[model samples]
Target chain A: MTLLLAVKALTQENRDFLAQYDIDVVTPDTVTDDQLSEVVISYAWDNTIGNKILSLPNTKLKWIQAQSAGVDYLPLPLLAKRGITVTNASGLKALPIAQTVLGYLLYFARGLNVYATRTHWEPFTDQYLISELPVLVFGTGRIGQQIAHHIKAFGGKVYGVNTSGRPVAGFDETFPITDYQAGLAKAQVVVDGLPGTKNTENFFDDHFFAQFNQLFLFINIGRGTTLNQSALLEAIDDSRVKYAALDVTTPEPLPHDHPLFERPQILLTQHTSWGENINAGRVGGLFRLFEKNVPSFMKDQTFIQNVVDLNKGY
Target chain B: MTLLLAVKALTQENRDFLAQYDIDVVTPDTVTDDQLSEVVISYAWDNTIGNKILSLPNTKLKWIQAQSAGVDYLPLPLLAKRGITVTNASGLKALPIAQTVLGYLLYFARGLNVYATRTHWEPFTDQYLISELPVLVFGTGRIGQQIAHHIKAFGGKVYGVNTSGRPVAGFDETFPITDYQAGLAKAQVVVDGLPGTKNTENFFDDHFFAQFNQLFLFINIGRGTTLNQSALLEAIDDSRVKYAALDVTTPEPLPHDHPLFERPQILLTQHTSWGENINAGRVGGLFRLFEKNVPSFMKDQTFIQNVVDLNKGY
Candidate 1:
């Protein structure tokens, strides 16, 4: 029987389907070294188990089904050198992540943050209506498009930024990465959803924030490496940014005394943007994607869904 | 000059427009009793001034342009008996109020409430997406329809309740106020946008909450008189209601020690749903409505826009 390493548990239905393909599933914790060496497919993720498999001298692993959209944490170069195929659960998280971005926006816009801590009833300061606010999202991928779609639902203007100034279906205007400064003048809210990559490193630096013509709410649901924390702090200090909602930080699990936590204007969602219906959204979505890829994998050991380009590291 | 009593300050433009008709605006504080008795029109609201004007024997107050949608505080029956024409800023607040309703929904659904108080990183419990949830809004007028419109934008199902089970433009389903229980089963969030009236008093009491089939979020951007506070507390205690965001509590400025403030599940927004762009929204909208009605009032002492049915007390 072909051994399949599942770092995460599979439903009984999935196990039964894998059995039909003459593949026996084994978990990293319980699987023998002998069984591990013969594993040809890995589902979900576990850093230690993944490194163990990669370090194996005679490993048979041919494909990996990543449980997340961002593959920054994965060893992309090693996977590419070994000529292994990688598939990701990209669009599955778009709904919840996009919903979370709205959550961050509404938190400040509606004064939920202030109301949460207040013991007395006070009239709010000037508040905003999404319909009257213009939002600029820094990536036009599934996640960014979903954010744009939600913003559009509120009748708010949504501007999208991508590698090229190619227009996407939902955005009112599209700007290329190099020309995004032009769209910054009227934006009351800016969101970062760019994936972590060499080109995106520290994309939202001081120079980027300096062009804003008005106070804006900044939200980051993308990789933390794409933002320069010091520059964001400077923007907040200089009053160029009114509030910052960070769901992704440079280090996962930001330390207890981190400076980001000190700012009253900064809200740290702690990288829980993909939290809504996680088990069902991630696992179920991955299983379906894997199910579709199984037939193709069996026929030619390749993918027909969410194939990641190792060079681009999406 | 025709005396016009304005309880609030008007913009220079609004003052200039009113001046075009040879009308001089006077604030409640500055208007003399002689001027008050001769006042033929009033802009905005002040309980003291309204009652004072209403009490004048043989007064010439022909009409009032109210600054808000709800006129419960105004003596409606007295106004009707006195032959005073009333026009309210109803649809003008629908956009901000609707946006606020969405803010309240997203607050609980995306764990903003939890994250707001937390200092450390924690994986969220099962959160929600508006798309997967069903929302029921009572009172399918401009405000309720706006709420439904915003919910529909997120791809969620919105059920609206009105006096009759008549279909409205945006709701997925319409339930008559008398038959709203039929739509209660699937609703994950319930909003009260019903205006303050005799029939609406204590509308969201124990019996109404008892009919809910699932754990739901309750929001009230409507008049606080419509909700029974004790019953809401009970609902929150029993877990039938997960969270409650009250923009309008039973009494404005709920006492610091009010029982409603004791519950962590309840968020008091202090009747600020109409807060977005207030100066412009209320004053500008009222001025425009008053502007459209000015010529009619000058000629026949009647209105052409937002004429309130004093008997209905909206």
Candidate 2:
């Protein structure tokens, strides 16, 4: 039996992440139908080919571990029919996403970008005190919670929204996904960390963007589909959202000709938030589980801690 | 009969902040000495005529308030000799400084700038996790303690150096400011937030920056004189320190010829971190001491909260 690590590309760190175990690794295109006895799949978010290839595999494909957290784009139907075990590198990316969101918030809240271009390096003006500013986090998952914690530490008021509406530890307020409008009204800086799912597709449309008053900074560390690009563009035109910090976009590697590329208010980051100290090493705990043939330190937990329920879709 | 507000150049917001009360505002350059008894006195850090004008008899300066936290540059001896009440806008700037320090740690500990310039938008490989990263924070004052809270929240191993070495609430490891060399060995990113005084000047010299095995980031939110610019530039050359975020620089409004301005690794901010909204509508708390003969919030205390110990040179 052979083990296949089917990823678009592997970094030295990614290889090191798998090296502890004796699994053989290959790209998705190289996996033969017969060699699926034990396959571990990995792909960047847009690796549609990897999804299709896994669906064509036999029962030997025991587990389909996604290289990313979002699985809506994965061929879920085929995996469900085959009863294949799927794990995602979800929580592993939480730290980076949280850091990125915090960075976006700091850049604005602390006004780093505003002062960066000035010849007079001291901010005599252009200061918006954080303690008075309001921040709304769209998702209360690991990333959202971490961001909320940092915001709270800064003396800013923090509000969060989650599917369950359960209280997050540090947020001043929390609401269910249903009270989105109320939450939006209370926060000037709206941050999106919600997972991309059917329930949240195009969640930030014209109506949502319009509800927000002007001069707010819109940040997306979550999947890009949550925002209606057209609506966001119009809002930018209308000066509703004064700035946009995008880490993930509806389409990866935004085309050079895209108008969004030229917008001064928008600061685009290639979806590389999760790459620092690349997360390949994070899966070492999983390898230790494989070696022991045991449930792991936490017992059958997802590669990242939180398990997203596929039935309702995260 | 006249009143004066001896404040820095008044912007619309500053004017609005003071206009709430009925005091007419005037600068040293605008006032005649004979009418001083009818006016309040305030001064920005760079008020060139502060010493010359305040020396006038019958300037009748009812009170002297400083727009700066550090009043050493002012003709303090002469003002004190005149029995003029002096106070500073210090606490008002803590939030912005604390916020900037937090950004420096999170961004550097997480390698944000590195990934931004990378060709592969995918993450770079890494072996160890951030849990292994060690961060040292200097100064345990209002801003420093706030930073420690954030560092610990993010799972960082935090060590701090303060004057007393007394255990701070959030720091896991602390050493007296004198014993920092041993602690510096463990710090990948050392944040300098100590106020400038005799003991603290040129604190980040060649010997200080040379301790780090890995290139790290340095954040300065305190006075710029505290960090020897010559030493930090040397660190950049030796690759001991990778980048720096300086909210204050020695001789602020850093000269155009300053080496820091030309270095991509250096982030020199205008000394404006403390003036944002936190100070707004709050300074009058001190103003009430005499303007209306109202007792201070800390009326019985020997010193106002955050009052600098001039002997200690803060």
Candidate 2 residue lDDT tens string, B38-61: 554443434455554565555655
lDDT of each: 0.85, 0.64
lDDT of 2: 0.64
- For model 1, what TM-score is found for chain B? 0.96
Residue range A1-314, candidate 2, lDDT tens digits: 23655454555655665555545676656766555444543333344645544655353554555556677776666666665555555565676667777776666666665654454444545556566668888888777877777677666898998877789888898988887667777887888886788888999899888785684689888889999988988999899888888788867767667777667667666776664553445455334323332134124422443333556554
Interface RMSD of each: 1.5, 4.3
Candidate 2 runs further than 4 Å off: A1-33, A37-58, A117-124, A162-170, A176-179, A276-280, A285-311, B1-32, B37-49, B57-65, B77-90, B109-133, B210-214, B282-309
Clashes of 1: 1
* Candidate 1 residue-wise lDDT, B1-314, digit = tens: 78888886788998888888999988877888888789988888788887887888968988888888888888888889888888988887898888888888888888878878777767576688887678988888899988888888788899988888999999999988888888777688889898999999999999977865556589999899999999989889888788999999867888888888778788888887876645666667767767898987887776777989999887
Model 2: per-residue Cα lDDT at residue A2: 35
Maximum-DockQ candidate: 1
Where's the lowest-lDDT run of ten residues in candidate 1 chain B?
B274-283
Alpha carbon lDDT at B199, candidate 2: 75
